[model samples]
Each structure stands twice: as C-alpha cells, then as structure tokens.
Target: MRMFDVCIIGGGPAGLKAAIAAGSQGLSVVLMDDADHLGGQLVKQTHMFFGSEQQRAGARGVNIAKELVEQVTSLVNVEVVLCTTALGLYDDLVLTYETEGSYRKLSAKKFIVATGASERMLTFPGNDLPGVYGAGAVQTLMNVYGVKPGNRVLMVGAGNIGLIVSYQLLQAGVEVIAIVEGGPSIGGYLVHASKVRRAGVPILTSHTIKEAVGVNCVEGAIVCELDSQWQPKSGTEQRIDADVICLAVGLSPLTDILWQAECEMVFVPELGGNVAYRDSTMCTSKPHIYVAGDVAGVEEASSAMVEGELAGLCAAKSLGVSGAHLTLQITSARSQLEELRSGPVGDKIRAGLLQAHR
Candidate 1:
C-alpha cells in the first residue's frame, strides 16, 4: 500500500493540469495513465485549437501536449506512472490499480478523476465490419501512428470531430466522399465546416447511414435522408462507394470510477452521456473525489484544462494548502470556464451543466 496527498487517475489535458496545480503546492501527487504516454487524446489532435492566448488557442494540440508534459515532468513532487489502469475506487477511498499485471493499492487525501470520454459508436447493419471505425480510432491511426485509415472514407456526423477528421483525412491523401449528419444542420463550428467544404467535400444535413455494405470489411455505405423527427425516409437511400466508414457521432463520459464510488450520476445528452454531478470547483457528490474533463461533462479541451486546474486548487485548499496566489488562480480558472461556456457555441454544454448541477 502507498499513499499520497493527491492521486490523479488520468494523464490527459485535464489530468496533467490537475497534477501541475496540486503538485505545485508542494503536495505529493501521483498521476497515472493506462497508456504508455501522457496527453491522452491531445496527442492525436494535429489541428490548432480555438481560444485565447492564455489557452494556447493558435497552437496545435500535439505541441500543447508536449508543453504540458514537459511542465509535468519538471515537477519533483509529482509522480508520473504510465501503463497503469485504475481498477476501482473503494468505499474507504482507496484506489486499486494494475500495472504490468501486478495489483497495487493507494490512498490519497484527494482523488481527481480526469478519466476522459470514449467515442460513441453508431448502430447500423455491418457496423461490426473491419473498415468501420470510430472517429478517435481513425485519428489515432492517421495522426499518431502515421497510418492512413483507408483510401476513401465516408464520414458520419458533421460535428467538430467529424469535420476535423475529414479535413485530416484529406490532408493524408484520403478521399472524403461526403459527411452526413442526422441533424438538420452542421453541429460543429462554421470554420471547420467551411474548411471541408472548400476542400470539395459535401455536407449532407438531415442524412444518416442506414447500413454499411460489405462481407468482411466496409466496401461502401447506404445513406438516406431523414425527416424532421430524424426518421429515415424510404426511397431516399443512396449508395456511396468508400473503403472506410467513420462514425463521429459523439462521445460519452467515462465515469466508471465515479459510479464505483457512488457519486451522483446524471444522463445529460447535451453533455454527451452519463456524467458525474460536479460543483463549480469540480468536486462531485463525494467530498474527496473530484472530477474534471469529460468525466464531468464532455466539452472542449480548453474547458477541460480549466476545470482540472479548478479541481486541483480546490482539492489542495481542502487539505490546508492555501494562499493568496492559490485563491487568485482559482478565481481565474472559474472565470475562464465561464468565458469558454459563453456564446451560442456553448449553449448545449450550458444546458447540460444545468442538469448535472441540478
């Protein structure tokens, strides 16, 4: 058994920020990630972010991850453990994790869960085919592994992920036949949607994939137009030829640890899926267990980073580590969050947060 002042159960944008915040206060911190490297999904994002200079808006996500990793590694009070999977959060506040087939137990005064979210899968005929992939998987293959997903791709969903990945595919020399969305309009930023459009890709709103046609792999897709109620319209089915069918429908919060801890959970479709009910400080119903990033609610990386810092500051303060500097930092993080969640773009997140906090 081992102990620390703080144990952060992820190494993504949120987890890394939390570790920096908590460890800078001279508290012992352990940051664990199942992958061999940190940065989580940030490592796969090649596109420049959108936000203020403080959030590194113009910087590419890969570069941002590198910078955050460098900062974290310099913190002597923080322990970075990779290839470690957190098994459960016990009632006694002890966390069990597995590393290299060995089980270990650790207890912390505060546990910050930035476990993040997984890409949501779409249901359709032949969805289990080999060439069918989630948007994240495609990003990892193309951006991280330097492997093209396919020669031509059919993208489902016009949300940011769908649009961004489509652009990335085009950059990789893969042909993006078209992007189909079940909704009435594109769900991502106009900037992203416009980028794909200028690249000669069509955006089909109120359209959805009805089935994937293939025997062993996705050879093509059958798509159709949708009515106002989102029901498929017969006789509108169109066959599109593509070697790959990518689904970027959405993401759902990974709150397994929260559920294990019995913290309050709510289903907020606007936020993605089931998420932990967290306060402004990112503290969940369970006092010692805090949540940030997608585990709390699905949002952009900028907001996740801010939430992580807020959670870390609050957790450290609860442990008697506080000063004027910490107070100011906390206030700044909250203000950034509010600003990020402002505007029409944040309407869905704002609605989701209202339900979670309720």
Candidate 2:
C-alpha cells in the first residue's frame, strides 16, 4: 500500500476542497473518486449556485469544480485518482480501492471521506419500468450525457430535488406535466417551487403517484390526492399523460465506508438518512478519520465544501501541525459555515447540529 499524508475519498466539491487545502499545507494529498472524472454531482449540475459572494454564488458547479481542480493541480502536492471506488476502510486507516480493472490500497495518516450522497428510492406499482428514474438520473441523462430522459415527465416529491429537477426538465426542452407532492405543501424552498410554477407547471400538493402506467418503458403515470395519513382520497384519482416518471423523494448519505470504518452514527432524516456522528471539528468516533460533505449528511454543495475545508484544517491540526495559517483558515471557515447554518431553511440544519452536539 502506498502512503500519503492525506487521502480524500470522493472527488466532488468536498473532496476536491479537502485535497487542495491539505496540499496547500505542504502535505502530500490524494483524491480518489469512483467516477472517471472529478466534480461528483457538480458536473451533472447545470444551474447556478445560491450563496454569498465568498461562496461563489451565481457560479455554475461545473465551472467551480473545474477551477478548483486546476488550482489544486498547480499546487503539485495533490494527486487525483479517477475511476477509483473505495472498497472499504481497513485497520490502521488503510483503505482498499479499485481503479480501472485493478485493485489498489493506500494508507493515510489522516483521512477525509466526502463520498457524498445518493438519491432516495421509492417503490410503487410498475415503477420498475425503464422510463421511471431518479431525479439524479434525469439530471445525469440531460445535463451530462445530452440525452433526454423523456419528452413528457411526471415529477414525484415536492422537495428541492423534485422542484429542481422539474425545472431542469423544462430547461431540457421536455414537458413537465405535473409535480405531485405527497405532503400538504412543497417540501423544498418556495423560490424553487415558484420558479416551476411560473413556468406553467402545476404543483399538486397533498398528492402522490399511485402507479407508473407502462408496459416496457414509461408511457403515463397515475396520481391521486392523499389524506393526512397518506391514504388515497376517493374521486381524486387522476392520470398524468407522461412518458417518464422522475422520483425525487429525497437523498440518503452514502456511508458504507464510514460504517466499515466503525464510526458511530444516528438516523437523522433531515440530514439525509443514516449519518456518522461527528464533533465540532468534523472528526468521527474513530481517530485519524474524518467525515464531511453528504457522506456525513445531505446538505447543499456549498455546505459540503465548507465542511470539507473545516475537516481538512481539523485533520491537519490533529497531525500536530501548528501555524497561524491553519488557525486563520479554520476560524474563517467556521464563521462561514455558521452563516450557512442560519436563515429560515438553515434553522432546521442548525437545530440538528445543536441536537448532535448535545
């Protein structure tokens, strides 16, 4: 196994930031990702990011990832490994991984996992059809591969993923027939919902998909109003003329490695499924191992990047590094992260953190 001062798993925004931060500190760093390219979900994202100027607000995720990668490469201390899937975390902070057709291993004095999150799945009658897909799948098909998921779409779920994907479907020149929300109102930001509505899309609140109606590929969808208990309301059943049904129920943290690393966890639904417990410094129960990004919990990419920076600083400090540079970096990063945990949407996140700290 090769050894490095720092090794980051997951090459998305968080992992990329971690590798850059560590490398800038004179540490030899490696960023490993399962995808053939860097930028995790960012590459599939074609929308502008929302955040403060310091957070690169209004900039596209693809542009941000490209710029970050370029800067990190110039540092010379960072090596990026693509098409690398982390097998598991072994004893003594050793990590097993796969790249191309070969197996590899690496040991890190300090490790950061920013593997990110995966889309949540929901099962319904006939949902196994080829045209039924996750919101991320729709995004991947349209934005990355330049392929349309379908011409007419029925979006399930009212959260950010659902709303955002609905809008992206329109952007891809597809017709979004309706967005069915199982809850009373939209589960995501009002701004995103408003954007969808302004584009002539109807958001059917307190509604759900009864089944995806198709034989081989998706041909249509069955939707109905739901009561408080989620039971279908009689006389309200309707069929949406659609070729694809995109499910955007939510996201779940991809935490297989964290679990293999033996980190303590809690099932926090708001933070996105099962997550590893971390301290203020983002260090998990296991020493020398850190968790950040969606692998820690599901949040915006901006939040993921901030946590990645903090994790890098904390990991560096844990390795007995002392300098004004690290102090300044961490202090600034913490303050920025604190701001992101404020605001209306952020209040729930902040409350979760308070509970976690407790």
Candidate 3:
C-alpha cells in the first residue's frame, strides 16, 4: 500500500487545483483520474469561461485545463496517475483503485474528492436508441475525438449544456433543428440563449420531448408544449426530423466514494442530487475527508477550482503545514464561492445549500 499526505480522487480543474495548492504547501500529494487525459469536462468545453482574471475568464476551458495540467506536472511534490479508477474509499482513509489491470490501495491523511458530475439522461419511447446521447457524450465525441455527433440534432433542455451544445453543433456544421426546454424560460444565461438565437435556432420554452422515433437509431423526435404543471398538451405535439436526440437536461454529482465513505449526504435538488455536506473549507462531516467541485455541489468550474484550493489548503493545515498566507487563501476562496452562489440566478442554489447544512 502506498501512502501520501493527500490523495485527490480526480484530475479535473478542482482536483488539479487541489493538488497544486497542497503540494505547493509542502504536502505529498497524488492525484488520480480514470481518463487517460487529465482534464475532465474542461477538455470538451470549446467556449470561453466566465469569471475574473484569477479564474481565467475569457479563456477557453480547454486552454485553462491545459495550463492547470502543465502547472501540476511541474510540481515535484505532486504525482499524477491517469487511467486509474478509484473503486472505493475504505476505512482509515484507504482508497482502493484499479490501474493498468492491477488493484492497488493507498492511505492518505487527507482525501479530497473532486470526482465532478455526470450528465443526467432522459427516458422516452426510443431513449435506448443508438443515436441518443447525453450532451457531454456529444461534446466529447465532437470536441475531444474530432468526430461528428450527427448530421442533424434535436436538443432537449435549454439549460447551459443544451444551449452551449446547440451552438457548438452549429459551429461544427451540424444542423440543430431546435432546442426544447421544459422550463418557462431558458435555464442558462440569456447571453448564451441570444447567441444561439442569432444562429437561427429556435428556443421552445415550456416544451419537452415526448418521444424519440426510430427503429435501430434516432431518426426523428416528438416535441410538445407543457402546461404550468409540466404536463404535455395533447394537440401541441410536433414532429422534428433529426438523426440525433441529445439530452442536456442536467447533471448529478458523482458522489459514490463519498457515499461509500459514509460522509453526511444531503439531497439538494438545486445542486443536483445527494451531495456531501461540506463546510466553507470544503471539509465534510468526516474530518479527514473533504469534497470539492461538483461532488460538493454542481457549481461552475470557476467555483469548483476555488473550492478545491480551499480544501487543499485546509488539508495541508490539518497536517501541521501552515503559513501566514494560509488564512488569507482560505478567506479569499470562501468569499469567491459565496459571491458566485449569490444573485438572482443562484436563488435555488442558496436554498439548496441552506437545506444541506440544516
């Protein structure tokens, strides 16, 4: 069994930032990721991110992820293990993972879980068809693999994923027939909605996909208007001819390790699903274990990186590694996170957080 001062269970923006922060503070850190590439969803994000300069605002996510990976690789105290799946978090902070056809266990004084989140799928009549895929899957295929998702697509959900993906599809020469949302208004930022609209794609609010039509794959889709209660109107059904059905409904935090670790879990619909109850420092109810990124709550990448740095600093401090700047770092990170979680758009997130800590 290998041991370290800190073991981060992901290699995304959050996990990478956590490793960099803790390792810079003189802690032995090891970061693991199941994917061969280090950047999680960041690699597939072609659009520029939002936030201040410190958060790399105006920079593409792929570029941001590349910069983070380069910084982490240059650190002597931090180790990066790719293509490794962390199977479980066992007693005494032991993490069991599978790597290169072998199983290994590592124990750490502090474990930071930044496993992120996965796309939420929808079930319809032909949901199991071959051409049906999550927004992330389509992004990965088009952006990462340099392959097209489909020639024409019908997108479900008008949230960030749905809107951003519709624009991306258009950029890639794919015809986005339209975007259907179950909500009364677009769930994502209006700026994104405007961009998609200018591209000539229609945004249908209070609408949803009733069924996908195809035998072996997605050949078309059925969309309809919904009432205030989200029930479909019978005569409002419209058939759309498309080869792909993309579901960008939402995401759920990947908290399996947290669940297996027996941390305090709370259901926060605003933040996704059941997430680990974390304090401002990102420390869960289990003192030695911490959570960041979407595992704590489904916030944006900017907040995730800040949460990760805070958690890393806290982990290092818990091990007796400290400096005058440590307190300032924690304070700044917390402030940024709070600022991000405020405002009209963050109302639901605030409510969910309050319920989680309660």
Candidate 4:
C-alpha cells in the first residue's frame, strides 16, 4: 500500500482544490474521482457562477472545472486518478477503491471526503416511469451528453436546480409547461425565476404534482394546489401534457463513508441532509479525517472550494508543514467562506451550522 500525506476523494471542485493546496505545501497528495472526468457536478453546470472575483464569479462552471483540473494536474506532487471509486473507509485511515477492474488500497495521514451530494427523488405515482427524471439527471443528459431530455417538460420544484435546469431546457429548445412548487414562495433566486418566467414558463407556487400520469413512460402530469398545511387541495387538479417530469425536490449529502468511518454526523435539512460535523477549520470528529463541499453540507461549489482550501491548508499546517503565508491563506479562505454563506439566502445554512456547533 502506498502512503500519501493527503488522499482527497471525489475530484470535484473541493477535492481538486484540496489536492492543489496540500500539494503546493510539498505534501504527497492523491486525488480520486469516480467519473472519467474530474469535476463532480461542475461539468454539467453551464451557468455563470455567483460570487466575488476570487470565487470565479461570471465564469461558467465548466470553465472553472477545467481550470481546477489543469492546476491540479500541473502540480508534480499530486497524482490524479480518474475513473476511480473510493468504496470504503477502514481502520488506520485506509481507503479502498476500484479502478480498471482492480481494487487498490492506500493509506494516508489525512483524508478529505468531498463525495458531494445526491439528488433527492420524490415519491409519487408514476415516479419511476421511464420519462421521469431527476433535475440533475436532465442537466447531465442535456448539458453533458448533448442529448435532449424531452421536447416538453414539467418541472416539479422551484429550487435553484429546478429553475436553472428549466431555463437550460428552454435554451435547448425544449418547452417548459410549468414549474410547480410545494412552498407558497419560490425557493430559488427571483432572478432565475424571472428568467424562466420571461421565457413564458409559469411559476406556480403552492402547487405540486398529484401524479406523473403515464403508462410506459411519462406522457403527461396532474398538478394541484396545496393548502396551508401542504396537503393537495381537492378539486384543483389540472392535467397537462408533458413528455418529461423533472423532479428537483432537493438533495442529501453523500455521507455513507463518513458513517462507516464513525465521524460525528448531524442532520441539517437546510444543508440537504445528514453531514459530517466539522469545526471552523473543516476538521470532522475524526482528527485525521476532514470533509468539504457537499459532503460537508450541500452548499454551492464556490463555498465548497473555499472550504476545501481551509481543510487542505489546516491539514498541512497541523502536520508541521511550514510556510510563511500558510496562516494568511487559511484566514482568507475562511473569510471568503463566511462571506459566501452570508445574506438572506444563507439564513438556513447559518441556522444549520449553528445547530451543528451546538
């Protein structure tokens, strides 16, 4: 088994940044991602990011992923492994992964689990139908594979993912029948909702899918208005024609490995789901184990990257790695993360973080 100073799992923005940070400190680092590509959900994000200049604001997510991959690959001390899956966490910080039909084991002094999050699926009639797809799946199909998800679609969430994917569908020449949200108010940014609305897609608040009507696949959908208690009201059901039913209900962190490793976990619905409990430095309950990105909690990719930088720098510093600017780098990263998590948009996240601290 080859030993490394840091083994970063899931080569998305967080893992890639962590590898670069640790490697820059002259630490031996190994970065692994399951996909043939390095970026997690970043590859499918075609929209410009929102943040300050340091967060690569205005840059497309695809471009940011490309830049991060290039930076990590150029670092001599970091080994990049694509098409690799980190299967399990074992005693002594050992990780096992499968690649090229062979299982490999490696041990590291520290680990950064940035496994990201999985899209939540809605339970409803005909949900498992062929034409029913997760919002992220639709994005991957259209953005990454260049394949149209469907010609006519009904979006079943008003969150950021649903709104953005609806707009992207329109850009792809797909017709969006309507966006149905269970909440009284739209969950995503008003700007995004406005963009979709200007394009003629109706944003129906306090509405939800009664059923994805179909036999072999989704051929249409039945939506109904919700009462104050969130139950579908009687006599308000409307049927619409749509070939695709895209569900963007929410997401949950991918923290099974953290559970296997016995890291302290907390359930934060705002952060998506159960995530590893980490301190300000992003260190989890396990001293040598750290977490960032969606695995820490389902925040944006920019914040995930900043969190990765904090973890990587702190991990290096904890290992007695000396650098004149180490302290400053860590401070700046933490500040940037705080700034990103500020504003009314981050109120839930702030509440979640506070709950975790408690």
Candidate of highest lDDT: 1
lDDT of each: 0.93, 0.86, 0.90, 0.90
Instruction: Please give, for residues 55-91, the per-residue lDDT of candidate 3 as tens digits.
Output: 8999999999999999999999898999999998876
Q: Is candidate 1 or 4 superior in lDDT?
A: 1
Considering summed lDDT, which 10 consecutive residues are worst modelled in model 4?
349-358
- Tens digits of per-residue lDDT for model 2, 1-358: 7899888999888888888778888888898888888888988777788888777899988898888889777988888888888998866878888887888788999889998998887878998888889998899888889999889999999898899889988988999999998999888889999999999999999999998887888889889999999899999988888898999998889998888888888887768778888898888888778888888878898988888888988888888887998999999888998898778888767766655542
User: What's the CA error at residue 91 for candidate 3, in Å?
Assistant: 2.7
Candidates in order, TM-scores: namely 0.98, 0.97, 0.98, 0.98
Model 4 misses residue 87 by how many Å?
A: 1.5
lDDT score for residue 113 of model 4:
91
**What is the alpha-carbon lDDT for the whole of candidate 4?**
0.90
Clashes of 1: 0
Error of 1 at 123 (Å): 1.2
Candidates 2 and 3, the one with greater TM-score: 3
Error of 2 at 114 (Å): 0.5
Task: Write down the TM-score for model 4.
Answer: 0.98
Model 1 vs. true fold: TM = 0.98
Candidate 3: residue 148 Cα off by (Å)? 0.4
